[model samples]
Target: MDKKPDHTGYWRTNLKYLLILLSIWFLVSYGFGILLKDTLDNISLGGFKLGFWFAQQGSIYVFVILIFVYVRLMNKLDQKYGYREK
Candidate 1:
């Protein structure tokens, strides 16, 4: 007989993924882009100051990437928890 999946563990893992991903996003957008702008401004990326890039476009790019990452993570999680669509 197939054993029942642990819903608590599944939920906990899902939440952990969310917290980690969001924290990364926040660090990049808020910490690097705003709080450390001056320090980042000293560096360059594609001809633009790193801080300026982050402030204007980096966060959006990171956000889109994070969305894809989340989708991928959730897919694996779903499969692990026997929740994936056949």
Candidate 2:
């Protein structure tokens, strides 16, 4: 007898959130941090240049936020899909 695969709803939901979070990361780190550095450099935040801060500290902070966001989103998704690892 052949076995059928089980469809886990949580997997798709997690993947969707993961892709979105990563896209935002890429845009902030690569696009704004490097590609638009010149334009950003024209702006200043306090004592630091916008682009420089984004490239160094800003992106890092955003990355941390993204991680947290992903975790939260995943946890919610898991509960919604009845996949929470209680």
What CA root-mean-square deviation does each model show from the true structure? 1.3, 4.1
lDDT per residue, candidate 1, 11-75, as tens digits?
A: 99999999999999999899889999999999999999999999999998999999999999999
Question: What value of lDDT does candidate 2 attain over all alpha carbons?
Answer: 0.82
| Runs off by more than 4 Å, candidate 1 | none
What are the per-residue Cα lDDT tens digits for candidate 2 across 1-86?
A: 74333245557767788899989999999988999988999999988899998898888899999999988887777566556465
For candidate 1, give the lDDT of residue 19: 99
Clashes of 1: 0
Residue 59 displacement in candidate 2 (angstroms): 1.0
The CA lDDT of each predicted structure is 0.93, 0.82
